[model samples]
Every structure is written in structure tokens, then in C-alpha cells.
Target: MNLKKIILSRTDAIGDVILTLPLTAYLKKVFPETEIIFLGKDYTKDIIENCPFVDSFISWDAIEKNAVSEFQKINADAILHIFPKSQIAKAASKAGIPIRVGTSHRAYHWNTCNRIISFSRKRSDMHEAQLNFQLLKGLDINYIPELEEFKDINLIEPKQELREDLKEILNNGKFNLILHPGSKGSAREWGVDRFAELIKLLPKSKIQIFITGTKKEGLLFRKDLVVPFPDVVDLTGLLSLKDLMLFIKNCDGIVAESTGPLHIGSVLGIHAIGIYPPIRPMHPGRWAPIGKKTKVFVKEKKCSDCRKSGRCKCMREIASIEVADYITAL
Candidate 1:
């Protein structure tokens, strides 16, 4: 591989961005000296900073404003469109990025991308990370590595100062559990009532519970979950994304609906139990957390209610006691 500097563009949600990191990891294994540039939204900067393989981060907004100059500044040898956006594709084309890779199914890619791979992500049985690797077919990487290979990718450790502050709420012998009740409308929630019930089911003496989410989500959950537990800590609105990333590293486990924090917890090697609905694309098979201690709770068969109603109780059906039992045992 003659590639020196390559840009992997994925300007999407947090979970999708997490799944795309393995691509950079795999490339670094094959081409150790290559510079990896991640072109993504401004909000995902912290995630880019955490990756050792990534040499730099280019904001999508900057690319949109001045694609030629941005590409000129870095002199990227290749560009991979993991999450296809017409503007980025066109910009890469205009900048004359030598080895522009994109999916053949996307009509715009034919005109913009120099190299294209024929693959369908929706119908494939592969995990999202594996499917993302398929876009590398143009580079003669024909096979997708297993889920375990992706899990082996390195992640940043928790900051020392962040751990010291968390010591106040974390018990010495108890399991530190972070319970996130909302999904920020990213995915269908498992319901706040279910999360509250799960909290009650856990042994307070053996478990330290902490609730985390945006301020708005905290307000939504405040009515039912306001009453304090013996060891439950409410940290919904206080922590920043950077702090949350470090905080997850200090915890023993995390229980949340399919969300960004769940992915972060799993990547950080914490026991992450992701509650998900059995819907296509959103199912565990596609987007489950990739880690040694990851577990998913999704309905077994086709969800009858959600298929018709567009709202799922399938995830809610996963009993709180069952999740609580597993977390305590962890």
C-alpha cells in the first residue's frame, strides 16, 4: 500500500462514528507510517482525540466552507466516504483526492469518486463496523475482519483527575453502575420507568448507581426518579462529553438503551448491557457494543407491536430484575 495520508469521512451520529474507528485501526496495522485524518462534525472532536491511530481531525464544516484549501492543507492521498454525503463527495472530487472511495450503489459516487465498491449495507448480515470495512474493497481489502478484530482497537484511558473526583460516589467493594435512561431521541428508549424499576431491583448495599444524560433528559426523568436512593447519584446535567468519557472508564458497568455512552462504556472495557428493540438496522446484530464485557437485551423474534405501531415496547418487555441480576453479578 502506497497510501500515506488518508481521510475517513463519517459526519454522522456518535455510535456510527465509534463503529468507524476500527477502519483506521485496521489501516494502521497494515500501513503503520500512514497519517489518518478523520473528517467529521465538530461535536465528535473528543472521540477523534481519543484515537491513537488518527493523526488529525478535519471538521466537516471547514470542508464545506473551503474543500479545496482544506484538502490542500493536508494533502490527503485518499478519501473514504463511510457515511456518504453529496457535498463531501463533490468536495473530495473537486480537490482531486487521488483515491476517492465510495459505494457504487450511490449514484453521485459514480461521477465524484474515482474508486467505487459494490456493496449493500442494509441487506448484509455483517456488523456496522465490518460493513464499514467493505468500503475499503477498492484498496484491495476484499474481506471484512471479525468482530473480535474490531474490539482489539485501542481506546484512550480515563484521565487521572476525573477518577479522583468520582471516588467520592464510588464505594470500595461495590460495583459502580451508570444508568442512562434517555437516548436523546437517537434510538427508541427502553422507558424511564423500566430504568427506575431496574435501579430499585439492584442491591443498594452492593451497587453504586449514577444517572447521566443531558439537562433536558434529566428534566424528563426528574419527576419519577427525583427521590434519592441510598447510593444513587444524579449527575445528569453536570458532566461534559470529555468528562463523561473518563467517568465511564472508572465505572464497573453501564446499562443504557442503544446510545453513544453505551458504546463508550463498552469500548472502555466496562460491562455494558445495551437494551435494544428488534428492528432492522437498529438490531443488536448491526450496532451492538463491540467489547469483551458487552451484553445486549433485544426481543428474540419479530416485534409485532413495533412493526405496526412505530413505537416499541419490545425493549421494555426485558424485565428490570433480569438486567439488575446480571449487573450485580458483574
Candidate 2:
């Protein structure tokens, strides 16, 4: 298959978008001159805007009818549909791109693409990053040694005046710890009482808490949270995606559940304690961040509800002291 222009469609949630970056980077590493375009959600533009590997990024929302009109100006050689069931794929197919590659898994609403690579496994089989990369084998780019892990940063800098304003807000402030108690992965959260207890455990005199989330999670935080400290900075529903990333970069560390921010922190090399439920899988080596600074807290239990979304009895048994001890070690 002679692929000159390529499009990777991964217009899903944040973690799925982040996990697919390795494929884009690998495509660039193998075929540096090839024009690589990424199709993702509108909000994720910043996540990949600075990726040197990607030639251009097109918002999936822009495909009103099909990808032909939007990508026609760009002149792509082929399209690689990561989440193939997306309407964007139909648009790309309608656009008359010669070659299209995607996963062969028939579980989800699998669409008809020209070339489908079969990497079907159980849901618990492989990391999403690896599965996405396997789709590239049709282009003779199949080697998937672990990609070089690095902090993901965009080049978008605030104006000089805005920078000064941020500096003023941070002046004379104690070290801030991002306490992200919000997650979309299943409803088995540690609850607000646990978060309040965690705050009470921290020495509030030396540290501050920034409760962060989007508009949905902001509502969740308010509904369940009982703040034990006065220094809590509830910035939920306030910061944009890039703003949240910047805020996380400045913080000392993050203590969060299995959320997007946790993965963001992992990508940034920030020390994070991922409060994983006991029922979840245990191999951080394959799934979570690979660096030494990241620590995962998953309690082992006899009967785990590991159906990817069931209630996990193991996570409920985890204690705050163990988490605090892990933080102290970090």
C-alpha cells in the first residue's frame, strides 16, 4: 500500500486520544515526510497541536456531511480510522480516499472501510495504545517497541499580560496539591467524605488543594464534597483543557481517581497516585505511566468485579493512610 497522505481518526474521549498519539508519532518516525493528519474531538486540538509528528489536525465536528469537503483542501492520500464507527469514517469513505485502515473488531458499530486489520482480543486483552498501533501494520509499520515516553506540552503560550496576572495569583502561595476527586470511569468513586478526610489528613498549613474538573464534574464535586480545609481552590468548570494542563504542571503532585487528569499527569511526568479499585487490572507496566515517579493503589481481593464497569469491592477497602504513606514516599 502506497500511502502518501494519511488521516488517523480517534475522535473519542481524552484518554483514547492520548493513547493514540504513539501511533501518530510512530508513523512520523517511519515516514517522516508523509503528511499525517489527526481527526479528534474539538476540545482535544490542544492535546496534539504541538505534536511534531502530526502534519495537521482536523476537528471531527467539522464533518457536517463527510470528510471530503474539509479534507479536500488538505489532499490526504489515505485515512486510518482508529475508532472506525465514527461518522467521520463515513465522511472519509464518501470523500473517495483510495485506502482506509481500521480495527477489525466487530463488537462496536464497525463501519465498512477498505482495509481492516484484525487485532481482535477480549476487552481485557491489550492496552488501547497497542491495539491502535496494530492498525498501522497494513502500511508495513508494525514494529511496536515501547515508544519514548515524554511530557506532552503545547506551544500555546499566554500573552505577556496574562502571564503577569497568573504570576500575581501565584505569589506568596504555599505549594498546591491538585486534589482531583472526579472521574467518568464507572460510578464507584471514593466519595466526598473520603476526599474530605484526605484533606483533613494533609497539613493544611503548608499545602493548598485545587479541586479541578469540567462543568459536569464540577457539579459532581459540589453535590458530594465536604471540604475540611478553607484553602480549597474550587476551580472546577472554570479552566479549559489547556488551562487545566498548565495548572497541573505547576502543582507538586496529583492525588486522583482513574480519570483523564490522572493520565494527563502521567504524560506530564507528574507524581500521581492513581486510586484504582481492587477489581481493576494490575499491570501498570503495560497500561499506566511507565516512569518511576507514578504509583498505582489497587487493593487485592478474592472476588473482584472486573467487568470494566462493575462495582469493585477492593477499591472500597483501601485506606487513606496507605495513600498518605505512598505520598510521603514520593
Candidate 3:
């Protein structure tokens, strides 16, 4: 099928959107003439803006209001429904996009999409990013990249102003280690109490630790604090998404539970240490960060259905001292 323009729809959260970028870059490399348009939530626009492969980014919200009109304006050759939104599938089909692509298992795609590829994420051994590449099967693009090569799909350097600000944050001559203790409910957390204890365990002189999360998370931690929270720098409420990327860019490493920051750190080629449980989809095998200097810390054996029980022994079993030692060694 000859293609000139295509829409790559992934209206998902930050990490999911970030994972989709490598496929975007790879497609651009293979089909240099195909204009790649990304469909995502308005909040994730910052992440797409940084992706050099994406020719344009259209908010899914904007398109939902008037699908046919919007799709006509986009006028793409095809639509790759990576995230499987039923409304989007119907819209693209109604728009008469010549080659509508999606997975066969979605069921909705059977009616809404003309070009469907067989895929099942549950039984697959591939990482989430690599799994997104499977949609290329419909286009007869059959290669899925190795995990290490995902780093090459990184964004252009952080903005110049962000770089200048980072210099000051790192002026203390200590290794900057970003400690992200919140996961925004996207994945199982490594516990804030555990993070505080780990901070106290790390060497004071060698590493400058920074605690990061959203303002709501900061307020929750503050209210929950029994003793004063540790002596690390707290930057929970302030940074924009772009600012956070720059901050992670300059830092020596990041220790985060399975979350957006961990993925960002990985793509930037920084030391991205992901703290994961042995949980199924959340396990390191499925969600671990990919970078030159990335590592995942998880306990042995399956972390079976712990979120429902309210007590996860395996995740809590990982010691603060062990994590501190790992960070300091890096």
C-alpha cells in the first residue's frame, strides 16, 4: 500500500506515549517520505513535542468533537490505532481513511478497521515498546528493535535554558540522584516510607538526593510524615514536564518505581534504576527501563495479586540499605 501520510494514535499516559516513540522514529527511518502524525492527550503533548520523528501532534480531545472534519484536515493515508480507542476507530473508519490499522483481538477493530493484525500482549515475551511495533505487520514492516537500541530514539537535547538552570542545581559537586517516590497510581509504588529510610541510608557527602512528585503527592507525604521527612531536596510541586526532563537529563541517575520519570530517564541515556515488583504486567520483564545504564530491582518469585490484599511482602521486603548501596555504587 503506497503511503504519504499516516496518523499514529496513542492517546495514553506519559510512559505509554514515551514507549511509542521508538516505533515513530523507526518508521520515519524506513519510510522517509511518510508524514507521521501523533494522536495523544493534550497533557502528553510535551512528550510528543520532543520527539523528532513525529511531524505533527493532534490532541485526541480535539478530534473527538468532530472526527470526520478533523480527519479530513489531517488527510492521512492511513491511521494506526495503537491504543484501541473505540471512538477513534469508528471515527477513522467514518473518515474513510483508506487503510485503517489495529489489532484483531480488540474486536471493535474487526468492524472499524479494515487492516487488522493478530496480536496478544498477555502471552508475548516482548517489552511494551516492542509490542507496539507489532502493528507494523499490517504495513509489512516486520522488524522489532532490540531493547538497547530504544535509547537511540531519544529526543533532541534539552532546551538551552533548561541546561543553564541545571548547572546551578548541580553546582554542589555531588552526584545528583533523583528519588521519585510516587507513581501517580500508574503502577505499584515502592512506598514513601521506604524511600525516606533509603534516603537516610545513602551517604550524605557523595550524593545529593532530590525528592520529586506532583503537588498532591507532596501534600499527602507531608500529612503522613511522622518524623520530619529526610534532609534531601524536595522538588515535588514545581517543575513542568519539560523542566523535569531537563532535571533528569543532568542527574547522574534516577531511582523510581515503575512510572513516567523512569521511562524518561531511560530514553535520555541516564542511569535509570527502576524499582519493580514481581507483578505480571508491572514486572521488570514487561516494563523495565531501557538505557545504556539501566537496572531493575525486584524480589524473586511472583508478586501475585498484591494490590488487592493491601499488604505486599515482596515489595516491602526489599531493604533500604540495599537500594542505597546500589545507587552509591553507580
TM-score of each: 0.95, 0.84, 0.94
By TM-score, the best candidate is 1
Task: Compose the digit string of candidate 1's lDDT tens values, residues 1-330.
Answer: 799899999999888888888888888888899999999998787877787778889888756788877787788899999999998899889888899999998999999998989888887788998999898887878878999876666654443457567667777688888998888878878888888898888887788888999999888887666564645788889888887888888888999888999998888888989999988777889899998799999888776567656578888788988897887777
Q: Give all candidates' CA lDDT scores.
A: 0.85, 0.66, 0.83
Cα lDDT of model 2 by residue, 65-180, tens digit: 55677867667787887776656666676677777776767433255477777866344456656667777775767665543443333222322122344444552456567878
Per-residue lDDT tens digits for candidate 3, residues 113-212, read: 9889998887788899899999998788888889878765565345435656556767357888898888878888778788878877788789888878
Q: What is the lDDT of residue 248 in candidate 2?
A: 67
Q: What RMSD does each model have against the real structure?
A: 1.7, 3.6, 2.0
- Candidate numbers sorted by TM-score from highest down: 1, 3, 2
Measured on C-alpha atoms, candidate 2 has an lDDT of 0.66
Candidate 2 ranges beyond 4 A from true positions: 107-111, 121-124, 147-174, 185-188, 223-226, 278-287, 290-292, 301-310
| Poorest lDDT segment (10 consecutive residues) of candidate 2 | 153-162
Clashing pairs in 2: 5-77, 66-91, 278-315
